[model samples]
Target: MERNTTRRWARLGAVLGTGALLVGVLAGCSGAAPGADSGSTDTDAALKEDVTLTWWTWSDTTQEQADAISKAYPNVTFDVVKLENPDAVVTKLQNAIKAGKGAPDIVPVEYQTLPQLTLGDALADLAPYGLDEYEDAFTASTWNSVNVQDQLVAMPSDSGPMVMIYNKALYEKAGITEAPTTWDEFAVASAAIHAADPEAYIANSGDAGFFTSMIWASGGQPFKTDGENITIDLQDEGTKKFSDFWGARLEAGELSGLSTWSDEWTKALTQDKLGTLLMGSWMISGMDDYGPAGRFQVAPMPTWDGEPASAENGGSGLAVTSQSENKAAAAGILKYLADGEGRALLNQNGFPSTIADLENPEWLDHPYESYGGQPANQIGAASSASVIPGWQYLPYQGYANNVFSDSVGKALGSGGDLNEALVEWQDTLVQFGNEQGFTVNK
Candidate 1:
């Protein structure tokens, strides 16, 4: 185990060397101040290292996660710094690297931002870190979020597979017979529900992020590449199909606009005022907290127009920063989290596992009685395999997503034109790419 660990860190060092800035960024990775080791004894055993590793992440339960860390690695100590906004993590990491102090050994990078992190040389390649050992443990596709230039940088953490959670009791009351499988069927069912109850309709948010998910699931790519210019293709067949379908539904007054992922929206879910929520695997975890038990049921996301596919929503990966003096120790902890008993614990605590393990069946067995005994983890396991694959990680990912959000929002807004909005977004992405030192094609 020690020999293997050495080889992994050596390989990891070589990869970090490719990015010039990382050399300076990682210069001050050693020195950790000793603390009283206050978390879980179990995690402390798993790490078993005589060093402390700092982790920068986003989570509601820092103490619980820290406890779990201690439980997994008894010898290794972890100092977790929690930050909420996804963008803040990148900013903080970059600042730490620049300051040459207080940098984390391991960091959690969202899948959407993988490309940007890799391009900037802000993260270390984790290939030598026993990635091969844990590769097969994760669902095949979700595991690649951190793969850039063929080097694996992150361990699969959680995934968001698209699902439609509905109010079964509400459907019964409205005399609606079936859950929607396609856009057409969804519209029909939504109309029936609306007619039965004047306040009900399918839920929609005029948000571009949600639209991007729908566009991909509907068999369309948002930006087409010509050498390097990301041209707007939102007016393509897939976009038109999605916009026309949803627009028609809205115009028919069979829909109610609710802000996305907010407390008010969750309240509507409990009230059964919304017919369906097109969300990801993590939705199941929120159900118990938001709605009463036995009121809802889970179904596959409504299809756009083909063999049903889901848009990849939320997922996280573990990246070992180049600056960590203890790369081997970091890798050991990541491997345990991705493959050992840690993955199962993450799944049970509301973070769906991206890694496949023997513990999978055990996790799935604890059904959510709130969704009428729905085996959501089981469903997520299957759905993870079918996610539409091309969420191409971009070097300027944060800028691109912002552009996508803006363009899609404009297109979906009342009187918004899809073509004009997309053109503007595409132009913005090109400008940002060039400014970030990347070659942008015209």
Candidate 2:
């Protein structure tokens, strides 16, 4: 119940710019650079206008956030629409963007979906409204995810820094007292755990997205584009080496062939048959809620070469849509959401991205019954700090992601030689790019 509830909140709206009709909507950013717009709009000037902006978000608390915003700028009225299904939100957004009308003033977007919403520049650029001023204000990677192709496209509301969540009781029963610090050590431990109890395994078989995180942790850049020149590399040393390790173990039964989040995985996790889960920090609340409690421990994810590294996962952002006739009002609302009362509302549900909030007692001091009273915020902050940068998602990541899932079975889907599957995934992406009219580079 807790996992489903929190995940719902995390899937809400984000920022980015768009269209020719959008040219009229964003009159201030007209003829602006494809990247950041001119940083000269007066946010206060926009706030004075009588505007009733619509916000499309997934959380039920959005109405509460809208109420706060309405109070902050009394002249600005906000209409908050709560959609229970994330796919429906994205579907409405897509329909609006394509028809060139009906899009909300602001909407919640997952960071991974920014490139899509902002495709052909359909969302409003926040830089002109002073969003870049807070560039140093958010965790670098989370901020980077919002800035598609060097432009401030969305305001990051929350982030999911990756970490290793292990069942402490399971480890103790397997005679392992410490979490592995390196992949070499991790593999050894995986073998030992399986040997100790044949029913136990380290992790699920996972999918392409899962491998993408692991690739990021290992310093691999799977997808990158320079305006027109796109580069695709899934067969990098790190990916190849990591795939080799896991593929061998999976075949040997050291690691479970179970898929993540499935009924099998949930039972294994609750029963302590699955020892460790390397995932985004958002999983902490789920672990605490679903598990027996006081039986979990978090550590920076194990590194490939023992270098300081980790990956990130599920995070959502907010953006101004092309439908808004009031850019100033929309930008103000986004800024307020990121740093104002909306931030508080966001914190009520998921992890925070505000720099000062990291240490603010109001944030860092939450000692909930979860984790047996450990200050989970500190652990979250530390995990976020360990993230290695330079990983980027392509503009067509959503399309490519689906294709990769079908082609490679996500992460070694149905199991053959995972390395060969990587090559196939690589070729498929390159082909998809060419078909989509991108100049595919090696």
Candidate 3:
């Protein structure tokens, strides 16, 4: 299973320099003819050029968004190709890059998968497109997630700042007056809820993404990557803290081990068999679809200390493929989708990553009928701002997620020691990373 580390690093080094010319032009360091605005002129010319960009996306691009992008760049048209899911897009994009052809001009890459793609040099550096100016446009965590090493390979599109969505009715029934602000309070609330109704628990701990996010929010540095080197430490203090706290609850039957997003989980959600859900702000958009309107309410995620802390659950970035024949045009489309008018349109489906959208008075104050007319965006904004920084995902996060059920998940229902499970998970990741030619340190 050994890979060519030397070749991969060489390719990445070359990719890092791909945007130097554009970077120089954008920085006004490119010596052009007097009174000649090279950066703007080049961008205008590229936008005005007749080009049809193919986009590979798992999420649907609204007709309004398409029309807006078209109006912005009349010369550019899109052939949107919808894939089944994000994983499918990743597989196809990887294959296309290896084949040196047949890749789309644009793709939506999940934040976790960006590292692997960048290491493989499959994406173009977007610094030349003046995207570097957008550093302040996004939340710090969201912005940092899209930057691999020094290269800006993608633009932050949507983000999933963690929040706790609870059933207000269920909480009231359990005699819990307010949402828990600390993990200690959460434990008490969990006991209260389970005692009130034997069938309902405070939350579920049977999801890999949820576990990873919990560890992140607890300030765990489970994974860190630098070029071909990686660090995997699943038994960090944060990891043990989360595992010990939740593991006790699982053993005491105060928490459910129902798998998230499964039919059974969905049934529990709709039937009010679950009291709270600690997930991302994106879940708010689908609250009504999950249960009766006004039943779910948003709250900041409970913290280890009685202070603000959060982590990202899910999100994606828009990137241009290196295999594209029309890189400039493709980059323009990405900008529109991520930073321009299309951003607002895209926000209709998910929580926004940009500061402008997050802080906009209208958006922040907008109340959701599904959330009992509460201004839930305020909670989402606060959580996004409070996300504990420096969380890093492994390059092979998809595989890590897939193997979680077998390792850490084995301890969930059985109430076994999660710290031991995490050690097993760490060993598995270390071996996988070494096999992939990475200098894995556990």
Candidate 4:
């Protein structure tokens, strides 16, 4: 799951190349320099090169994936630097680039932040290196994430398809036989659960990221661009439908007004004071840690009707920095790391839905007590494919999300004018984008 509470997504904005201020204290990114004798040839002589590559990551991914990649290239050694802070990673990377020294050969950037990171041009475009050959190897959403203006910015690593997890006991207590298939049904369930137990809610009030996911699920295209000019449609029908639904629920006291991932919310979840949690695939493991054993069940997110659609929540990929001396070697490691075997190894720490692994028979085998032995990974796999297409993010999406939270998030809990709040958030984003040398659209 998350490295920490805020670090999980707050650093989603970390990809921006803002802040010219250079901090002398760089986060640790250590490894030995490459020796001589490395070659593209498969000859034994190439083994003598022993290229050591540094990778900076906040996710505590095990070394198995790195080790597997090392076997693919005997001359390559991976020095994995697993940090806990995502913001520090962004700072160290930018500062290193500014100073022209001390950046890691490879770094992980979330898909949500890739568009923002592209503005800096610090990531190497792998299209020139023939990375397009593997273009169809990953899913469409993942493949799309790696490309910005036809440039392959990074290799797709893992995916986090948005879904809902419910407290099984709580749902049963409220007479919910199956997961709510539609939003109307969900609302009915929410009302029933709260009426039966006034202390409980169907779900808690989440932040901008969660709202963005719901917007995507409703097929709302919030952010997009046509080369130079950006088009941001925050007040779309889908968004209005989503917000109005939640707004009414919040007013009726059927939904918890507490912020997601907060201590109060977590307590509610553990104590069965909440009914369901609308979140991403990574939350599978997270829910286990927060709730008592055998109390939760995974299900596809409730839809407007019965159509399958979702939003990508938290996913990351590895990008070779433009500053890396061993760009070719770094790309090789990244490519090897995203393959089937590498993905399996990576999935040990984080859920993966890469092209090869998504359909693997083993995906349906991993059982969680929280899911009551259900193949939750399979549910995540299916949701990954159902994500709404053309759902793009602004280059300054992190700043926009922050602004949305500051304005709209505060309004959501108190049954304030959510539509007005969104308008304010949109205006703030337009201003930010225009100031950052972009043509803003609304």
Ranking by TM-score: 3, 4, 2, 1
lDDT tens per residue, model 3, 130-242: 77878988999999999997899999889999999999898889888898899998999899899999999898876778889999999888898887889898878888888
In candidate 3, how many Å is residue 153 off?
A: 1.1
Write one digit per residue (lDDT tens) for candidate 2, span 1-442.
Answer: 9999776666542112235456656654442223222233787778887888888888777887778778878999888888875557877877766555677878888787788667756678889888788777788889988988667888998888888888777777778889889988888888888888999887777765677777787777767878777888777776777778878876676767777878988899888889888878777666765586577877778887776787778778888875567766789878777775667767777777777776687666777564677667777787788787878787777676677666666445455777777888888788878888889874
Model 3's TM-score against the true structure: 0.88
Q: List residue ranges in candidate 1 displaced over 4 A.
A: 1-49, 98-101, 223-232, 253-255, 403-405, 411-415
Score candidate 3 by lDDT.
0.84
Which candidate achieves the best TM-score against the true structure? 3
List the candidates' TM-scores in order: 0.81, 0.85, 0.88, 0.85
Model 3, position 363, has a per-residue lDDT of: 89
Count of clashes, each model: 22, 25, 0, 0
lDDT of 4 by residue, 1-442 (tens): 5568678566655643233222322323222222231323232333346778888888765356677777767788888888666656766776676655677878988887777667665677776555667776788887888888768999887778888888878888989888898999998899989988989989887788788888888888878876668977789988888988888887787778787768988889888898887877878777767766778889998888798888888787889776776677776666556665655666676667477777778766778777677878888888888988887877777677667777888787677888888888888888888888889883
Task: Write down the TM-score for model 4.
Answer: 0.85
Q: Which consecutive 10 residues in model 2 have the weakest lDDT in total? A: 31-40
TM-score of 1: 0.81
Model 4: colliding residue pairs: none
- The CA lDDT of each predicted structure is 0.69, 0.76, 0.84, 0.76
Q: Looking at candidate 1, what is the lDDT of residue 379?
A: 65
Model 1 steric clash total: 22
